[model samples]
Target: MKSNPNFLFPKLASTIEELRQLSISEERKKVLRPLVLYIQRCVQESKTCNLNFICTHNSRRSQFGQIWAKVASEYFGISANCFSGGMEVTAFNERAVESLKRSGFKISSKGKGNPIYAVSFSENSDPIVCFSKLYDDRVNHVENFAAVMTCDHAEENCPFIPGAEVRIPLHYKDPKEFDGTDLEEKKYDERSMQIASEMFHVFSEAEKQG
Candidate 1:
């Protein structure tokens, strides 16, 4: 695999550079270590690294995880398949979508209740198609995948993920708590950037291990 900085849109690339500069706490790094090791093992075995980011609602943190993991792996020249799902289906939160847009991603959506979003960080690569669905959704890889629990609720609720080769709990605070308040956007963007920073860190370490 070859690094493809050219695959990202110019503005998104700039944003990602900024995210890389953000700090990851030791505690957070410990949580992300398993993920880094998983990617390295995949690299060693010449296997595709498949990740499924799951949450209770599938609307916020999980979505961020899936998108950033995909971007992080691609940016580091790793081959990976990334997906997101939840215990229950719900639309991807609009606030989270706006936060991603502010981070320079190009996103568009279609459908009614739970719209399918086409999210793109790169001009050259195909956009990631995102929607709310069950963890076992047909669109996701059935086996040979890592199950990344991005919320405390989901981690506790999902005792067993049938096809997961490994289960990693990487919980993030919900920005949904600020939904109707004055701090909504700030909180959402904060959470989004936090996720982005950590994900980039994970893949950066994985790349080194490779």
Candidate 2:
């Protein structure tokens, strides 16, 4: 990975440390380590790595993966691109946006009828481009990218991704089950934070190796 003189290593390290304090399953740690190491290899080789996080609804887990990947890439001084899509077309959920905002992401909504939300990692960084679309449509022409399955349904249903060099399954539980309860928002926020924290931890380890 190319080194940046302005890279904020201390801040990134602290962020990862804080995130690691949150709970993560042992099963998840196993999958996350290899996946992150793969990303580190791609970055080290100076390959233009493109990542697609897939799910059934393209609303929750996949979205979180996409955002966290982008943020982690920036944090590690890696140049990588991240995208997310689902098997079915669905608008971005408001709860997801709110959860990200609560976790230090800046989100701006524009357009109409479930408009695409522009998400930025930090105030000065370029915003990550986000929209609701099917996985195939989103990655129709892209080749040589990593396809990460963030939901079990998507991973099982779509066995083959035409252009993906590496296919990794990183399933996450849907927080939607807790919707409409007193813990609805809290659950969503917790889910978002969990994804963010784990991703941060994984990338921080990769950075250390470099």
Candidate 3:
């Protein structure tokens, strides 16, 4: 695969290896198939492939999904826009931010409770701007995008996301369950890698087929 400079960062480089090592399960593929097809269709039609990942809190999984998806798309040279939002606004947890740093994203933040983070996966590529906000927040694309539910709570609660051309359920186990425990870091990194793996699979598959 032609590599992107951001993906080549030593910290993120290990993550690329981890993602490559993962074998996408059939169950996971079931969720990803529709997303891949949707992205491919967008490309074929010359439309923007925007993806917005949603969760109840938007502190963790949704944030990871959005960042990794954008990074993977850049790696594979797909022109996809990715974002994350929650049903309720919460600060993007520091723990979650720590996990991303551990995964090799160079991160910086401003503000206190609701800090906006500039997360860089590579030097040559644009950083993924991250924060927690409502799904309908002005920062997110309101139209011609897919609503990807990263948590079951969000998928079940938000049955009617307006302006979403497609809705895809790509749930992940919340690592927040282990927060404040000894395994918190492990669980967070595990969740991050899982999302990174799937995103790599999605973008890689789209590139192959398109």
Candidate 4:
């Protein structure tokens, strides 16, 4: 990992600046504390943090968690690898993709049914490869990684992840409920920004620990 990740594209940087202004509730901060400590441990040990964000479908909230966590790690100059997965395979939701684009992410995708998206926040950093698969997919770290459950369903269904060093429940509300409605874009953007803000908080706390 780059010691100091490259500067984000101007638009993305602006979006992140906006996210930084959002306030996280104390209750929510309590829920996020475990993740903060997990990253702090990695920082203290000089270990590369591997985060696997898991949800039921691996389409919406989980993807946001994966993307924002990676961005936050980079912003804080933390060595981290972020991944997202689900209990069942599905395509990354298009609405979520559009919301990310609105936030200034540069994405290119290929394949038919389940296109793989290459998502980038900075010009020099390699794009994060995103698609839907199980949490234990070969592409993800096999052990010594944090299994961050991003949805209630995944946390309930997956009681044990064989290789995970810690399982943290950092659940997020699904924006999929607003799909096909006038509020679709609004809700997706809200959830995406919410996740982005929270991830930034987590990394910021970890950086403070260092």
lDDT per model vs. reference: 0.93, 0.77, 0.88, 0.92
3 or 4, greater by lDDT = 4
Comparison by TM-score, 1 against 3, better one:
1
Window of ten residues with lowest summed lDDT in model 1: 1-10
Off by over 4 Å in 2: 1-17, 23-26, 138-141
Give the total clashing residue pairs for model 1. Answer: 0
What tens-digit string does per-residue lDDT give for candidate 2 at 1-210?
Answer: 443324333444455457768877788788887777777787678775678888998888888888887787786777678888888888888788888776666679888765889886655678876777787774433777788898889999998887888888888889989878999888997788788888776777777774
Q: Write the per-residue lDDT of candidate 1 for residues 64-130, one digit (tens) a residue.
A: 9999999998898899999999999999999999999999899999998999999998878899999
Clashing pairs in 2: none
Model 3 residue runs over 4 Å out of place are: 1-7
Better of 1 and 2 by TM-score: 1
Backbone-clash count (model 2): 0
The alpha-carbon lDDT assigned to residue 90 of candidate 3 equals 91
- Estimate TM-scores for all models: 0.97, 0.87, 0.95, 0.97
**Most accurate candidate by TM-score:** 1
